[model samples]
Target chain A: MDRVPILKAGDVLLVSIQTDLEDRTVMALREDLAERIVRTGARGVVIDITAVEIVDSFIGQMLAGIAAMSQLLDARTVVVGMRPAVAITLVELGLSLGGVQTALDLETGLRLLGAGPLDGGPSEAQDRR
Target chain B: MTTQPGEQTHIVELLRSRRETALDRWTELAGAELRGRLSRGELRGELDDLLSLMLRALDGPDAEAAHDELTAALSEMSRRRARQAFTPTETAFGVFALKQVVYELVTESGSNRPRLTEELMAFSHTVDELGLLTFETYAATREQVISDQAEQLLELSTPVVKLWEGIVAVPLVGTLDSARTQVVMETLLQTLVDTGSLYAVIDITGVAAVDTEVAQHLMKTIKAARLMGAECVISGIRPQIAQTMVALGIEFGDIVSKASLADALEYLLARSGVRIVREEAG
Candidate 1:
């Protein structure tokens, strides 16, 4: 199983998944993300799936689970770069990721996290935290 | 009744003797029925070719092969007529008219009346088979045309246009069905990804009516777009559609719906932090 790499930028943790996520990989990602959120004391987490082309119910649940877990750790989770097809499939599958924040791309994800573009000042994400 | 070889030759000879007369009479009959939809000369040409083919089929040594060739020719003519929007009656009459011409020629000859009547019956049977074949082909061709038109309409109806740098709009202009809604959803979602548009406005000004099913489809589409991190605004709700939706107890929830496309665009622009100001002309 390939391990998903999690990169830390300032107070945000960025996880750019570049491969097909298997069940074990998702579980590992969830555990690893929870651990890193506490260790780095990050206020935001951005999961970039621009390269992910396929997803199943397991992965959908994992995303919502990650968002919920991060919130408990005093962190906001934003899933970004979701392909239109994937988003549609998730919606059809009755998993809208209701509690998870979404962005169009990594830049927007970072901005949503209030970790990019200081010119816009602190975003609502920062104010809430 | 099967046509005897001797009777077949006799009828073939009679037709060969007066081919021109038979063709002229057949063309006149068919032309009158068509009522100038096809030129007289063009109808004569078609009948001339068919008469020669029929003669060859009766006179040819390989009866089976010649008959198949004649059927193919009839099918080809039927397909052409079908495409020209000729009614099934008009097309079958073109073949059936030949039977009348051959009967006239047989009676005018007046040599072997009894035997000739038997041969005429066989020839009439062949013409009936040919006429029925033409009818079947015409119906099949008409069905093919209808299905092709339906496919074309499906492709032509849905169009996603970029309304602004970060906005796209789908102008729906017909009755909404499941198939069309699926197409609209896919196209709008794909456009959103391609343009990275943060806003989508579904303009339904041209849509004739809205029912619960259409409302459900719209809600599903809006939810899908929102899942992709884009906001969707439903616009151009005519008063009747609004009343119908309310009467049906359809709730749009917190989704921003505006009366006109202009309102939707204005709302999206404001949400995107773009301020529109009036500039005085100097």
Candidate 2:
């Protein structure tokens, strides 16, 4: 059971999954991510799954669960770098992970969390506000 | 057992002796039907090869082996003709013509009337079997061709074009069946990942109709795209399609859908912070 490493970058917690996750690993990740979110007082959490090629219903639920848990802790969760096939499988499995925010990559994920440049400066943020 | 060895030899000897006349007549009959689609020399060469194979099948001690070789030759010719777009009738005629030529030669010789008729019957049966073989091969080849074209059409119709740096569009232009929708979904999603495009526009203006199934497929595609951190906009909904969707109670549920692709692009560009300004000419 390899532990998934969670790296903290500024106010965002980045979790890049580099191996196939089992049931135990997913459970552990959920617990560990929840703990890290509160301890670091992170504003955002980014889960990079670009290297993950396979996923099942359990993993799908785990992602949604993680997002929901982070939101309660006052942190926005953005699942990033999802491979196209994995995303399609999750959709076909009826687990669209609707509650979770997604980005194309880590940088975009961070941007969605407002940790990256707003691109258009304060005017863009004010416009949205 | 239907064809006696003696009868077989007699028929084989008759064909061997008048091979020239039989070959010439066979080529003429088949070539006339083809209308120069195939060159005369090529037709003659193919007929010559088939005639020799038939003679060997009748005259040889290893009858089974020779028959296999003959059918193999017939199948090869049928397959080639099929690929060349020759009609089934034209292909079968290439084999049946030989039967006509052989019958003419047997009647012209005019020897052992009843016995010759029996031998000719056996020869005719063999030729009929070969003729039917050609039809079988021709149909198989035609089916192969049709399926290949269908697969190519599936691939050709589902092209994911990059509309902008951060945007891609899949212009679906056919009936959206499960198989085709699966293709479109996979292609669109893969393009989103490959190009890292955050915006996808599924322009269904060319789609023939919109039903519950098609609407479901479209929603599933948009949802999948969203799962990958990209937003999908359904564009090109004609007035009739819009009516059909509304009548069927198909709700897009917050997915941004615009009337035209230009509108979708405008909305996406604005969302992405791209400002398009038209300066007045001085």
Candidate 3:
């Protein structure tokens, strides 16, 4: 399935990470999706990784790379929905996504993407085709 | 406070045997340095005198060995130590004993002294790297090195050793470096050619990471297995690996990555009509 982790709102691709994102997979996803998000002219992008179980140095670097790439595409990026296990692993492995935006949940993630609160929630954004 | 006397005696006996070997090597090395030109003779007297003096020195201080030839061997060792920048410390005895070994080999008539010293030094280094300063330490290190060697052998061991024909399993674990990969492929290919195993399982469940290079190597291994009339099964792919494979777009044209070793075993057993007795769950 051609799944891009980023979603766009008025040119912003608000991405929701659905699986464990390591370096290779994340790079694959980013290369596949970054152009699409940029072309849409999204103001800011949000990445939701609540479902992820680990965030090693490789994944952290990918996020930072994606965030920088998104900004060059004229969109600020926010990473939201980080699981505690992922955070702990990231810290223990000495990793960080320096300068990447972060939020507690999709609501904040969506807000950081320059979209106001949805009438429903991320379920609504996910529900859209 | 309860100790098994059996275990203690076993250790003592092991040490005794090890000491005998070390002492042999030690004497042989030390004797090499004192070798002087012999004009076509057994030259047994010089060897006997040196061995007697060494044994006495080892047993306790013997007030002798004013022999000019023996002292020359000792000086040669000191020169080597000085060249290697080794100070004569307490540990120098170990070095001294070893140097004496090389010296003896070198001084022996009809012996290429330089080559013998090189061999002995390499052997000495191997012993040190094996983490045993003395032969007695070999009890544990030797066992460990043997297991490490066992692991190495598995990497080199052929998947196909035919009892009659048609049975093979290659269990892979740890890191798969190129050398190991080469060994594994050779073993598997040779086995497939020999036994003509109808079913071969290359179970990689024990492997933690399945990168693209490894995944490609697996493909090559599978292809080679097929050329020899063997069907290959790759077992033990966890969820993460499955996801990675999907992301990497690794097409399983023919090779099957099953769940576990047991699953692969069951699959093979079913094909071969070997019924497995299932133990009732607790």
Query: Which has the greatest DockQ?
Result: 2
Predictions' DockQ, in order: 0.41, 0.53, 0.01
Model 3, span B239-261: residue lDDT tens: 89889988998777756767986
TM-score preference between candidates 1 and 3, better one: 1
In candidate 2 the C-alpha lDDT for residue B21 amounts to 83
Q: Candidate 2 residues B1-282, lDDT tens each?
A: 122345566768877888888788988898886666789999999989888877767777776777788889989999999999899998998888878888788778877655776777888888888889899999999999999999999999999998778988999898999999999988998888888899989999999999999998888889889999999999999999899889999999999989999999999888877889999999
Model 1 TM-score is 0.88
Considering only chain B, what TM-score does candidate 2 achieve? 0.90
Best by TM-score, which number?
A: 2
How many collisions per candidate? 0, 0, 23
lDDT of 1 by residue, B1-282 (tens): 133445566778878888888888998888776765778888898888888777777766776666677788889999999998888999999999988888788778877755666777788887888899999999999999999999899889999988787989999999999999999999998888888888899999999999999998998898888877888999999999999999999999988899999999999888887789999999
lDDT of each: 0.86, 0.87, 0.55
Interface RMSD of each: 3.9, 3.1, 22.4
Spell out the clash pairs found in candidate 2.
none
lDDT of 1 at B148: 100
